[model samples]
Target: MRKYLFIFKAELMSALQYVANILLHMITYFIVIIIFFYLWNYIYDDPTQLINGYSKTQMIWYVIITEIIWNIVSGRKLCRRICDDVKSGNIAYNMNKPYNYIGYILSSHLGEGIIKSLIYITFGIILGRVFLGAFPTLNVLSIVLVILSLILAVVIDTLFIIFIGLFSLYIEDANPLFWLYSKLILILGTMFPIEFFPEVIQKITTVSPIYVICYGPAKLFVDFNLNNALNIIAFQFIYLAVAFGLCGVLYAKGVKKLNVNGG
Candidate 1:
């Protein structure tokens, strides 16, 4: 456990060294918030109001929370790191290490994720205050649910990324696969809420883990309803279990096929 924590700390420190890059990434998302705000405002401009079930203020706040969760769930470099390590023969070194490789990778990611989430949430709240007049309501129960959902989002997202990373053992080129996965996230409502989707598409997205990561927490933070919030929490855990089971099978098989060039 200590060894893994050390690795996590190392990764976090390395990330901190690229202070400019981190600031740029955070600012890029702030731009995204502005883009969505304008886009949605135009769509909802009519006096009759095309969108129902949420006011403009609520919708903007929804986007803000989704962006915060996204900062944690997205931007993982696990798959790319795995591919690089495998290609460079560094995976051989990892195999001989005392720590479990998957645990080490996960811990490293968790550390970076914690830092990114804090930065994004702070910027997101400030952006909301200035641009959208958004503010979080104070409630202990709601805050607890938001935290729980955020943790589940990270776990489920990491499991999914690990599953994708395992493809490196089978596929000759993992870049194309990574590209496709990224595109899917954008189209499938990771950046924007799925309420923008058609009814049928919205129904489909509701079952996907990505929706749980972004939309579930966004809704809970804004509305703070107990019943639906609890339901989303339950679904997140179940999705996480399925993700872990799938990744376990893939990891077991991928290790057998791993090819290590010169030590």
Candidate 2:
């Protein structure tokens, strides 16, 4: 545990060193929020109007929360690093290390993301309030639940991405798979709420990773219903277990294959 914490600290410090680069990225994030702001504003010609059960404020805040969650956990480098390590045979060196490879990647990415997530959430709230002119109505308990859900969501996301990355042992490259996974999340989860889709599609998406990964936290924040919160939280835990198990299985198989290939 201490070893992982050390790795996390190292990665956090490394991210801080590149804070300037992250700030530049924030500019782009803000630009995106601005674009969505106008787009939503145009959609809600009347302030009292509701689209898919979301008022104009709720809808805009939904986008802000989803974007923040996406930026925070969208650790694309996890896949790239895994692919590179396998291609260069560098994973061989890490195989002898004390820490688990998947855990190391998760810790490092979480550490790297901490600073960026904080900055984005901070700016996201201000922008949402300034432009959208409202915030999610939340009490103490709901706020706690949302935070817990987000933490689990992050772990779930990391595990799935690691699973995809470990496929490099079979596919010889996993970028395309990551791209496809990302697109699915972006379109089904990030771009709009599940309610915006047809009834058939909505039911299917609720069972997908996107339900917990991108939609769960955002949905809870914007529309804090206790029943829905409990449901999303339940699914988040189930998906977390599934993702962790799949990652372990794939990684074990991939490592065995790597050894057999003598590479």
Candidate 3:
């Protein structure tokens, strides 16, 4: 446990050391916000008319929350680290360690996710306030429900990414899989609400974990209905369990098939 925490802290310190890199990322981040701002503004045409229960201000807040959740749940570092370790044959060291490799990876990933989400969410909220007058509408209980749903979203996303990363054990290049996963998330409402989808597609999306990851929580914040918020939380947990179960099986199989070369 202590070792995992140390590794997480070390990774965070390394990330912070590149101050210019962080600032560059922030710039790109703001560019995305601006692009979405104009895009949504154009889509609605009339900002006053509510579309699918979201006003322009609420829509901007939804984007902000979605961006934050997308960053946290995507596990970008985890995928890259797994690819690097596999390519460099450094994963052999992890295999020999007494600690569970999956758990160690998850903890480190969660640490990075926490830091990135905090930075982006804080910046986004401040930016939204300045430019869009966007703010969350949830009361105390709804806020609690949103938090729980977000945590479940993180768990489901982590499991899915871990499963995806395990493909490195079998394939020489997992980058394609990573790219496909990212594209799916982007297209499946991680960046926007599922309401943008056609009615048939939107119906399908209601059961997808991607919808729970961002859209559901964004809805909770924008609407603040207790019953619906509770339902979203429940659905998040259900998907979390399903994702984790599948990952457990995949991890077991992938570890057994791991080939450590030049060790």
Q: Which sections of candidate 1 miss by over 4 Å?
A: 46-50, 74-76, 136-138
TM-score of predicted structure 2: 0.95
CA RMSD per model (angstroms)? 2.4, 1.8, 2.3
Q: What's model 1's overall lDDT?
A: 0.76
| Model 3: residues with Cα > 4 Å off, grouped in runs | 1-20
Write candidate 3's Cα lDDT for 1-263 as tens digits: 78888877876776566545645667777887798888888888786878876788787877777777776665676687787887788888987888777777877777666666667767877998898864666577777887777777776778777778878878866767978887777777666678877899898889887777777887787777888877888888788778777777877787777777785
Q: Pick the candidate with the highest TM-score.
A: 2
* Model 1 C-alpha lDDT per residue in residues 116-209, reported as the tens digit of each score: 7778878888888998665767488788888898788777777777778767777744656767765666667555567778889888889987
lDDT of each: 0.76, 0.87, 0.76
- Name the lDDT of candidate 2: 0.87
The residue pairs found clashing in candidate 2 are none
lDDT over C-alpha atoms for residue 196 of model 1: 74
Clashes of 2: 0
Give the Å error, residue 47, model 3. Answer: 2.2
